[model samples]
Target: MQNLRRFILKYHFIILFILLEVISILLLANSQRFHRNRMVNTTNDVVGKVYEWSSEVGNYFRLNSANKQLAEENAMLRQQLSVVYDTTTCTYDIIKGDTLYKYIPAQVVNNSTNQVNNYIIINKGAKDGIERDMSVISTDGIVGVVTDVSRHYASIMSLLHSKSVVGVRFKNNQEIAGLKWQTNNYRYGMVEDIPTHIVLQKGDTIVTSSHSNIFPEDLMVGTVEEFYPTAVDALNKAKIRYATDFSTLRHVYVIKDLHKPELDSLKARLQ
Candidate 1:
């Protein structure tokens, strides 16, 4: 008790000075309009900063939920856009009659692009109505075709694969071409069988052909970046920068062609 009294006596003057200074500032702030306004402004600034920090923390924790919600919303939009409306009828009966394709949204569980033959694995499979030969696409463009399917997963032969050939053509004049990944480049591929007479322009967009049974007509594939003739009589081949960045691929939709089975059966009869 005696030691504590001596310590307080030594530092009491300093403590008193601090307390008095605080009191003086408080009184001045209360009496002066400028000081009171400054005090209120400081308080508001501090509170605002605290609120912002708390909001950021909350958002950080909810990121997964936000992503899942976004995926679901995109899925719904894809479904709505997949249907074709036949509006030729006089009455309102045939306005919303035909649906050409159905979409099943799935997350890319695994993906590869560096190999000669790259493939993607999606979370949806037979149980989710995913089947072999179903077209896979992202928001930007076509991804691949489903090659194999299991109960809960499906493998896609990515557009980056060497054997991957998608029937494509220019959107301007519908000049048919074949799109294939001949090199290991992930950003670009080669479009073969483009006519030499069709003056190729840089940045010309290429898209899926109308005759493609796997993908709907006019689905964007890539843009032409370069072109050169392989031989004197051969068609010109052009390098195209792929629209879909496989490295950033996350969500995808598996498209089931409604009339594909019937088309396949009819083709099989010829053989």
Candidate 2:
């Protein structure tokens, strides 16, 4: 404190001169219209830049919320697509005014792609209208099926799981087959039981078949990247490039079969 006082005393004259100079400049700027306008312009420019920086920072923080909102909007839009409204399956359930399928937007809170039984956890569950056996998909293609659910979260069997299987068909010829993960390669899946007469080409898209009531018809599953004409147990198989990138999956939609209870009831009578 004593040293600061001494320094202030020593430089009092210089400080006084600097202050007077600043004051005089301000007075001159205020008195002259041209100088006053320039000062105002300079101040406005600096303030505008500061506000712009602040706005950018705020937007950066809100990016997650923005993405979630967009996902929800997309889910609503998907619900309207003709593929989801399977008119052919409309039974008495239709007389009750129930839509065939509905989409529930969800955020992936956890995921695993390396393990043999890879699974995904989403930030939605029974409370959010999600349930067991519901189908999960990303913007690009199928991701998994719901296996379990809590009030606020649900577990999904990722398509990369060894036990996971989806009924898929070639988009061109409509030849159906079973798709499953046969190896640890998360980037690829496998399709088995390709029809004897069916021939596959490079990049042939595989889509979900109506047989899998869990998913809506024609949802993209994957594409055939390579074919193995060799048979295992007298069955033909092919390597399918995964349509959904499990490693980077973040957002997904859970599909609900509105008439599932009615369908299950009818199947139970057969049993």
Off by over 4 Å in 1: 1-96, 229-233
TM-score of each: 0.65, 0.65
Please report, in order, the local distance difference test score of every candidate based on alpha carbons. 0.76, 0.77
**Model 1 per-residue lDDT tens digits across residues 1-271:** 9999999899999989999999999876563432111223344345435544554565566679658857886787656655644334323343243677887888776677897778777767678988778899887789998876666667788988766778998988779988889757899998778787787888999999987777888887989899776668668888999988898776788888887888789999999
Question: What TM-score does prediction 1 earn?
Answer: 0.65
Residue by residue across 1-271, what tens digits does model 2's lDDT show?
9999999999999999999999999876664432111224344345435544554565566678668857776776656643657544544243346568888988776677887777777767678988778999987899988876766667787887766778888999988888889757999988878866677888999999989877888999888899878644566778999888888776789998888899899999999
